[model samples]
Target: MNNVEITRAGLPDISRIVEIENNLFPDPWNEQAFRDVLFYYSNTFFTLKSDGDIVGFITAGIEDTSEVLYGHIMNLAVVPEYRKMGLGGRLMQRMEYEFIVSGAEGSQLEVRVSNGDAISFYKKLGYSQVMVIGGYYNNGEDAVLMMKWF
Candidate 1:
């Protein structure tokens, strides 16, 4: 709620996104990965800005298969200083809104099993745990798959 603005991210924002990713995650996505997403999945990529600085971002995509289409949240992150301020929820809501507008039936994401806070946050947004995947992360951490039906 710090006057945050959500906007589509572009190539110019990848460096800053990479910086935040490296600082926040143990197995961070590199510049090339960001570049790939921005280039191929630009429509679903968004950045949260505050006073002209990038404070957070969410990367999502539409998955269409078997006559069903749904949204997939690939990554979501906010700077440590900006956490717990409802920014994460706002970002998610914004993405969900987009998904709803795009004819998506629901949204899905995977959270690290050890990330209790994130699991709770997703639960607060009406996401339910569907299952657990073993060794989902490169670091050997399990992941809890969560889904929300629109």
Candidate 2:
């Protein structure tokens, strides 16, 4: 993690973040979506930089319901060259830490059901499957909802 920094993302970082999203996911969020998230939920959007280059990012937000307050991880991804270097896990840990500090009781996220690697990764991080949502993606794929209580 030498020379790597994790910081709150700004509008200036949207283009690079969008590039990563497009490269990693089939249904990527557009620039406007990133802009909205940064504008409305700035506290939960973060970017990872290595040697001054954008390499990864994670987006999450606090969800307040009548029953409970929790954190929802909306998106997370690292550039291919940065994968397996502990960057993803570090990004997740940072987000969860922020959530915990913000009084969230737990955190949740949805992963593509077909993404076994991601499922395993989340599981290793102590996230367990809570439910499955059918047709969760624009492409009609299912999503596995996972959660972890702090």
Candidate 3:
């Protein structure tokens, strides 16, 4: 395993990130969503680089309330070749750190209801199931909303 570098994604990294997305998820983010993450929310969108390759990545945004702020993890993926090497953990840790530094009181994400592996991962990371949304995906699959507080 090489040094895992977590950094914000630049315009040039968009294509590779999209490739990672397509390789990792059954339904991946579209090009415009990737562009939005970089162009509009670059500060919170991040990628994990190993030997100059995008091995893992995550995107998030801040939500403000009257008394505090929160962070929402929009998407996360780790290249199949890079899985089980702590790359996913590294990416999540980086995102949580950013949330804390940005005064976010909590973090949230929604996962495919049937994705047991991801559910377990989030559970180990201290995220607890909060709710479920019916027919959340384009194919009418359900989704589970999970959350954790820093």
Candidate 4:
């Protein structure tokens, strides 16, 4: 972890990010989606590099509504080889810091209901389960909505 570097993701990083996404997720965001996000939320998109290779990444965006400004974490993934190395937590912390500085009142994300490990991870990060959305995923998996207020 000490040797890992966290930096804002660039256009050139999208292909690698898409690779990680496709490998880790049941339904991954395509290259175009990553590109759109990088274009629109560059500040909130980050990549973790170790030994000059991208090992993890997180993407977030500020959702401004009439009632509040919320940080919406869209996607997060770590290469299989890099899992459980505190890299994901580091990415979360970095994204949270950006949300705070960007005037977000809170942060939110959705995780698969069956993913207990991820749910516990979010809990450890101070997020509480707010609701469950049925058929949230393309494959009809229910999603647990989690939120944290800063």
lDDT tens digits by residue: candidate 2, 4-61: 9999998889999999999999999999999999988899999999988899999999
Q: For every model shown, what is its TM-score relative to the native structure?
A: 0.97, 0.97, 0.95, 0.97
lDDT of each: 0.94, 0.94, 0.88, 0.94
Write the residue-wise lDDT of candidate 3 on 1-150 in tens digits.
Answer: 677798889888888988888877778898889998778778888889988887778898888887879899999998778888777887888888989999999999999999999999999999999999999988898999999988
The stretch of ten residues in a row with the least summed lDDT in candidate 4 is 78-87
Winner by TM-score between candidate 2 and candidate 1: 2
RMSD of each: 1.0, 0.9, 1.2, 1.0
Predicted structure 4: lDDT: 0.94
Using TM-score as the measure, the top candidate is: 2
Residue-wise C-alpha lDDT for candidate 1, range 1-150, written one tens digit per residue: 456799999989999999999999999999999999998889899999998799999999999987888999999999988998889998999999999999999999999999999999999999999999999999999999999999
Is candidate 1 or 3 superior in TM-score?
Answer: 1
Ranking by lDDT: 1, 2, 4, 3
lDDT of 2 at 97: 95
Model 3 residue 112 distance off true place after TM-score fit, in angstroms = 0.3
Any residue pairs clashing in model 3, and if so which?
none
In model 1, how large is the Cα lDDT of residue 132?
A: 100
The predicted structure with the larger lDDT, 3 or 4, is 4
Model 3 bad stretches (over 4 Å) = none
